[model samples]
Target: MMLSAQNLTLARGGVPVIAGLDFTLAAGQALILRGPNGAGKTTLLRTIAGLQAPVSGTISGADDAIAYAGHADGIKAMLSVRENLQFWAQVFGGGAIDAALDAYALHPLADRLAGTLSAGQKRRLGLSRLLVTGCPVWVLDEPTVSLDVDAVAMFAAAVRAHLASGGAALIATHIDLSIDAEVLDIKPFRAKPVHFSGASDEAFL
Candidate 1:
């Protein structure tokens, strides 16, 4: 298994969000998390990426092997597209910036300042960082936000190529990504409140 979670639980700000969840991802596979807003999808992805700890349970096969991208683009606005990619490539232990630029169709924007790109173009630049990371697993949250139809298609193709090379991905998004993936609805695991209707405060001493 490239990544596996067993009896996992997660919380945000002292409120339980997901509980007793289990899932597994292997090489060349994609798992799409489907849920409404406030459904803990982002939390789950964050936990798997090791940005935060799970409230309970265990996760295996994710140590030092994940590249995570959240809602924020994380790109420096003043840097050119190629400069941004080059910086990340070095930070992630070096990679082919040319390939990453080509992967996200960023060649034309390579010399353009990141601050000047449109929202969709900036999103594509943000995503190109994943390629430079060279990790086997990708943990993404709302990765396609602000992308046009053609850009979405480009991202889908990039994912397909990644999987073909024995990589895996875990994505959380509400929109259709146009890729073959196992869908996981996270609603069933959402936490429910415990009620104490009509019970006295000292009933149990």
Candidate 2:
């Protein structure tokens, strides 16, 4: 599979935040997005996730083949670890929570409420959703935001495994993630304001 963006432009409240962005990623490959705050890192990811409509240009190759994990982790506060996994399994298509939990070292907290878990724990839970589906592309924004060193390593390991298994990923992160990936610097095209409505792509480009 291949992911591409052509002269992508985006606006929020009618203000430009990203302009003329373009790139492509191949299966078993990864792209790292780097930029300062307000640089449209998250917006870019959202756009590729098909949750945000660009104001101009086009984002191609984002469809049923992708999985998006936003910065928030998307964990249900009211649910326990297991419950959360069960819910995501239903959405992403059921996968083994026991194995995923074990992989993320969350087995001990499987019965605990997601609201009670630490920030890193929540990120792990949210990322584990990747394993619940067979989607070929992944869009992750600041996936290691609150993770510790070991956890970060674990995260990289899992993502590497995913790529090795023939998947692609677009990651927006500030911390240095020591993984082999094509780097795309978005500072030059940083548009201000960054608008997103989680609507149809037709409304934007």
Candidate 3:
């Protein structure tokens, strides 16, 4: 498997949110996380991406092979689109950024400062970084936010291509990308409220 989480218990702000969560993703496959607002989907993705620690359990096969994109677009506003991609490529030990530029149709804006682009354009640039990461596992959170219809299609196409190239994806998104993927509902894994019996336990809570 490319990524697997067994009996994972995730937390936000030191309080458990989801418990006993288990999932796996192999090469050429994708998994979508489903839950309502404040359902800990972001927390779960964060843990898998190594941004934060899980309260408990094991996440295997996600050490250096994962590329993560969270709610924020991880880009340098002062850098041009091409420059930004080059930086990430160098950081991830990837190759040329030409393919990434073409993937998002950013050839025209390659030299434009990332801060000068519109919301959708910036989002595309951010998504384009995935192509330059050279990682086999992708972990994304609300990847389609601020994207137009065409931009969304572009993102979906990129994901499809990644899977075809023997990569895996774990995404927490509400929009359906029309790709072949399994859905995992986290509502069932909601953490139960812990009753405090003493002052020390209350302090921990």
Candidate 4:
């Protein structure tokens, strides 16, 4: 699943953030999107995920080939951690819940409701949702937010393994994640007056 953005112009409320942005990623290649806060990194990620349509240009790739994880932890606070995984597993048809839970070290919190979890714990639960998605292109926004050193390292290792298995990712982060990826600076294509909405992340799914 190759992702290509050509002459991509992203905007909010009719204001352009980034224009003439072009990028392509073949399998096994990771592209890291680095920029300061409010630099339209999230907007670019949203556009790529088809959650937001570009003001101009086009984002073309395999259908149902994308899996996105935004900065917000898309967990139901009322539900237990394992319940959340079960929901996503059904959403993507099926997946190994126990495996993903163990991978993110969320087993201990599996029976606990997400509302009772800390910031880092919630983030781990959020990331575990990725394993339930059946997609080759990963569009992750601020993937390491609220994560500790070990979690961050685990996140990177997981990404590395995904890439090694011919999976591609478009990751946005303010801090360095230390993955072997091509860096993309969105400053050159920042959309002015960007007002993003309908971005509950899952609603777009």
Candidate 5:
């Protein structure tokens, strides 16, 4: 398995939000996380990406193997598009940026400062970083936030290509990307509130 979670419990702000969650993603597969607002999808992804500790449970196959892209663009404003990709590629050991540029149609904007690009362009640049990471597992949250139809298609193609190359993805998205992926709704795993028997326990709750 590329990633696996057993009896996973996630927390936000020190309060448990999800419990008893179990899922696994093997190479060349994708798992789409579906939930309404305030669901713990983001928290679960973050935990799996090793950004934070889970309230409880064990996650296997995450060490040095996952690339995460959150709501933020995670780019340097002062750098050009090419530079940003180069930096990430180097950080993940080393790789040429040409494939990443071609994958995301970033060649034309290679010389443009990242801060000067439009929202969609910046989002493309941000998403392009994934291709340079060299990791086999991708953890994305709302990856298409600022993308248009064509840009979304580009992102989807990149994901498909990654999968074809034996990579796996765990994503939380609202719209359909037309990829062959399994949907995992997290609402069913919402954590129940802990009961308080004593006045002191009430404070903890």
Candidate 6:
């Protein structure tokens, strides 16, 4: 298994959000998280990415193999597109920056400053980090947030190529992607309600 969660419980701000969740992702497979706002999707992804710890249970097979991408672009504003990619490739131990640029159609914009790109272009740059990481498992949150249809398609193709090379991915998004993946709805694992003792009835008002 590339990633596995067994009876996992996650929390945010000392409040439980996901509980008793169990899932597994294998090589060449993808899992898509589907949920409404405040449904613990980001929380779950963070836990899986090791950015935060789970409240209970255990997660296995998701240690150093994961490459995480969150809502933020995580790119330096003053750097050129190629510079950004090269920097990450070096940090992650020298990956194929040229391939990454080509994958996202960033070759034409290689010399352009990252700060000057549009939101969609910046998002593509952010995603290119995943390629440089060379990690087998991808953990992404809202990866397609600022992308256009063609860009989304490009991302989907990249994901497909990764999976074809025996990699796996875990993604959280509201829109449909172009890959075949198992859908996991987090509603069933919502945390149990907690009761608080408060003197003021106006708190609810």
TM-score of every prediction relative to native: 0.93, 0.88, 0.95, 0.88, 0.95, 0.95
Candidate 2 lands at a TM-score of 0.88
RMSD of each: 3.2, 6.5, 1.8, 7.5, 1.8, 2.0
* lDDT by residue for model 2 (20-100), tens: 988998989989999888777878888888887998997777778888989778889999999998898888777677867
Model 4 per-residue lDDT tens digits across residues 108-139: 88899999999999999898888777678899
What local distance difference test score does each model get?
Answer: 0.92, 0.85, 0.94, 0.85, 0.95, 0.93
TM-score of 5: 0.95
Candidate 1 lands at a TM-score of: 0.93
Candidate 6's TM-score: 0.95
lDDT agreement of model 5 with the native: 0.95
Clashes of each: 0, 5, 0, 8, 0, 0
Candidate 1 achieves a global lDDT of 0.92
RMSD of 5: 1.8
lDDT of 4: 0.85
Displacement of residue 99 (Cα, Å) in model 3 is 0.9
Candidate 6: clashing pairs of residues:
none
Clashes in model 2: which pairs? 11-195, 12-195, 16-192, 17-191, 17-192
The runs of at least 3 residues in candidate 1 whose Cα sits more than 4 Å from the true structure, single-residue gaps closed, are 194-205
Tens-place lDDT digits, model 6, residues 127-196: 9999999899999999999899999998999999999999999999877886889999999999997676
Per-residue CA lDDT of model 5 for 23-87, tens digit only, reads: 99999999999999988999998999899999789999999999999999999999999999999
